[model samples]
Target: MLAKSFALAALASAAFASPLVVPVSGGDTPPADQVTISGITTSGTGCPQGSVGQFLSADRETFTLIFDSYQAQIGPGTVPTDARKFCQINLNLHYPQGFQYSIMKTIFRGYASLQKGVSGTQQATYYFSGESAQCSTKSTFTGPVTKDYTVEDDLTVASTVWSPCGADLPHQYQVPDHA
Candidate 1:
């Protein structure tokens, strides 16, 4: 099990990105048809070049990212870097007129294996490019286990921070390199 191997497409890039934000305004759902992902890019120690990428479904409501080398392991002989890895993914999206979005929730699914006394963590931070305000979520795994996992960050309506409209912004998800 790779603990925090950072690259995530099914590990949800746009899924994580879309999985990260949904457009809305005036209590109306943003036109799904008008919202489309324009671009996506990822970088991190958890995601070296070519180790991550994204795929969008035909209906445009869903997408997944596949990571080949994003994994973490810790034991004798394992390097320090094996214990944690992270990918920062940016999704540039076009929104409908007069509409903006908020990340109500995000689901991160992954494989994990841990020995007693150790723990794992996966985190995502959502923010618009060049903006100081942001929203973040985190999930933690304690050791003495090995299995698949799904971590969801569900934000309360009051707590949800929305993406501002009228500008081309890249929705960014990340675990800071030092974290």
Candidate 2:
């Protein structure tokens, strides 16, 4: 009886697997356009301890996305002229097509971190946007995707902020227009 129960459970789990193609409309071929995401930008500011020598470690900082891209970036694009407080980082693609790909996965992976310090704060914001076809509907995920971290002498604080800042694609399944 236990073996039979296990088989039923396995069969039920298999029924809820990810679908190959998300159905948008009832027709065989729904009106769709090819949307490609070339790249994403991760930018933010950091504040370090007051001491001149006490600096935040770039090695411990990160802004990553788990989408279909060629490479991810770590650390600031350019060294902050003022490293003590309010340092900024901007990373852009050198090549046009390096990180271009399609939007297959719904939940995109994102992460950011700042090392522990006497007193400091770090924030990473990722921006994602693009034009959508006239007949398509935009995604519910809206802008200013952000992650914030604070490092105090005693404790560390972190948070994940969501925004509608991602490649704008239409609904997976299409809907007919009303006259």
Q: Best lDDT goes to which candidate?
A: 1
TM-scores of all predicted structures: 0.80, 0.18
Q: Per-residue lDDT for 13-131 in model 1, tens only? A: 33454433344445666666777877778888777789876787776665677776676666665678766677887877777656766556666666766667766667678777788
Q: Could you tell me which residue pairs clash in candidate 2?
A: 24-173, 24-174, 128-165, 128-166, 142-163, 142-164, 142-165, 143-163, 143-164, 143-165
lDDT of 2: 0.20
The CA lDDT of each predicted structure is: 0.65, 0.20
Against the true structure, candidate 2 reaches a TM-score of 0.18
- Kindly list the per-residue Cα lDDT of model 2 for residues 66-171, writing each as its tens digit: 1211111223342332232222212221111112212222221222222222112122222222333212122111112223221111111122111122323221
> TM-score of the candidate numbered 1?
0.80
- Stretch of 10 with least lDDT, candidate 1: 1-10
